[model samples]
Target: MVSIGYFLSCEEFGPRELVKQARLAEEAGFERLWISDHFHPWNDEQGNSPFVWSVIGALSEVTSLPITTAVTCPTMRIHPAVIAQAAATAAVQCDGRFTLGVGSGEALNEHILGDRWPPALVRLDMLREAVEVIRKLHTGRVVTHHGRHYTVEDARIYTLPEQPVPIYVSGFGPASTKLAGEIGDGYCTVMPDEELVRTFHQSGGADKPVQAGMKVCWAPTEQAGVDTAARLWPNELLPGQLAQLLPRPRDFAQASSLVGRDAVAKQIACGPNPQRHLAAAQQYLDAGIDELYVQQVGPEQEAFFTAWSKAVLPELR
Candidate 1:
């Protein structure tokens, strides 16, 4: 059976609320968790981006569900070796119930340190090297490496889980998908594209897990949900590299002006109807997702979780 997980949106909630949400999710029958890691929210309206690792430490005490970083960029802003250390510590804290989900990263988060964001190919190369560094560090041995994009000098991770933390790579395109297969222990992506799942398996990720995440708003009415989604996540409707290239929340908000409530409603599962929510998750399952992660887009997480626990998730299971 495909596992159902709750996605903790760091962009939308503070650290305490995220921990609370994780506890609520476990009570509501979510089997796992996916937490986003970002230095900034997509737009000002989302209003928050807390340090995800700190939040994970809090979650370890509050909830027993396994956690995964929905996607973290270990290539810039934070060095891969540092990420390896953090992931190792997290795994130990979570008692080996952690997965490190990584991606090439967006300028919105990576550019904060005054580092020039490289092109997509270069970022992927950097990500590969970073993953190599992380894996090397996880071995609990001193590692020294001089690579094209990163340098590690006699570094080692002292604390680790008995089982190595699984590293999942995120992909949005063909090249990334191929790389995820080649280098990642598993694959993480938002879309329910069967071809992408097939590609991951055909290339090198056969029998590995593919995780898909989506956002929904369960409100008193459809229009209310649509409005909330549009106001908070209109950037989701932006096509192509706009999500990667837009450096600031204001820029994203400006671009998102073109995205209408109707467009968001059409794409996201919105409203009080449980069927609408079920269908959204069903699409991902049909596309061969091994794990499904769902997030309530706005602050109505209480209603979403209550309704899903009562109605939606039982049917899905």
Candidate 2:
């Protein structure tokens, strides 16, 4: 079955908001949930960044749906050993409904450690090492690692679930996508470009669950929805494919403001029509992804959910 899901926005909601959303999502018949792990909201105007791990912990108590950090960078700011431990505790708390989704990370989230952000190539290497480290520690046995990007000796996770948490790796372009296929239990991305999925499977990601996401704003008019998405997610248009670069959230917000609404609208789907919303989601399903997590961008969450559940979901099902 194609798993349908939603992305919990840490950028606009606090812990209380997340808990309410998680409950509503499960009650709405969504199967999975992904939450953004960020120390900073992309923009001050966007306003909200509750510590994600804490939010996830509360989610364990409130919902039955599985949850994952849509993508967290274990190699920077936080050590992979710490992530392994956190994942273990989270897995136990959630009753096996947790997945550790990882990525190379960006300056917007991971650059606060005062270290110069590495290039994408180096970040990929670091990501591999981080994954390896987390995997080994998840076994609940002591591990020692001395890799090109990480150094850990005698680390272990004591409170692990009976089964190790699955790790899903996120990628933006071909290189990281292939790396995710080769190293991850699954591949995750924002764009539903099937070619990227093909590249991953060709590189040995066969049977790996593919997950992709999109943002939408349900409104009375197409332009109204587009305008809301642009206002909240203008960062999508920041030049130079920033998913690979940029080290600070402040920088992200600043760069995003430099772009215009028309430019931001080109990347996201925003419309008043249910057909357009369904079409936007179809792009991900057609890409061979195993899951589609939609982020409802405007204040019309209940309406968006009602429309999607009534109009789009049966077709996907």
Model 2's alpha-carbon lDDT is 0.85
C-alpha local distance difference test of each model: 0.94, 0.85
What residue pairs clash in candidate 2, if any at all?
Answer: 107-246, 107-247, 107-248, 108-247
Largest lDDT belongs to which candidate? 1
Stretches > 4 Å off in candidate 2: none
Off by over 4 Å in 1: none
lDDT of 1 at 218: 94
Question: Per-residue CA lDDT of candidate 2, range 11-94, in tens?
Answer: 878899779877777777888999998877787767888988899999999998988888888988899989889888999999
Candidate 1, after superposition: displacement of residue 179 in Å?
A: 0.4
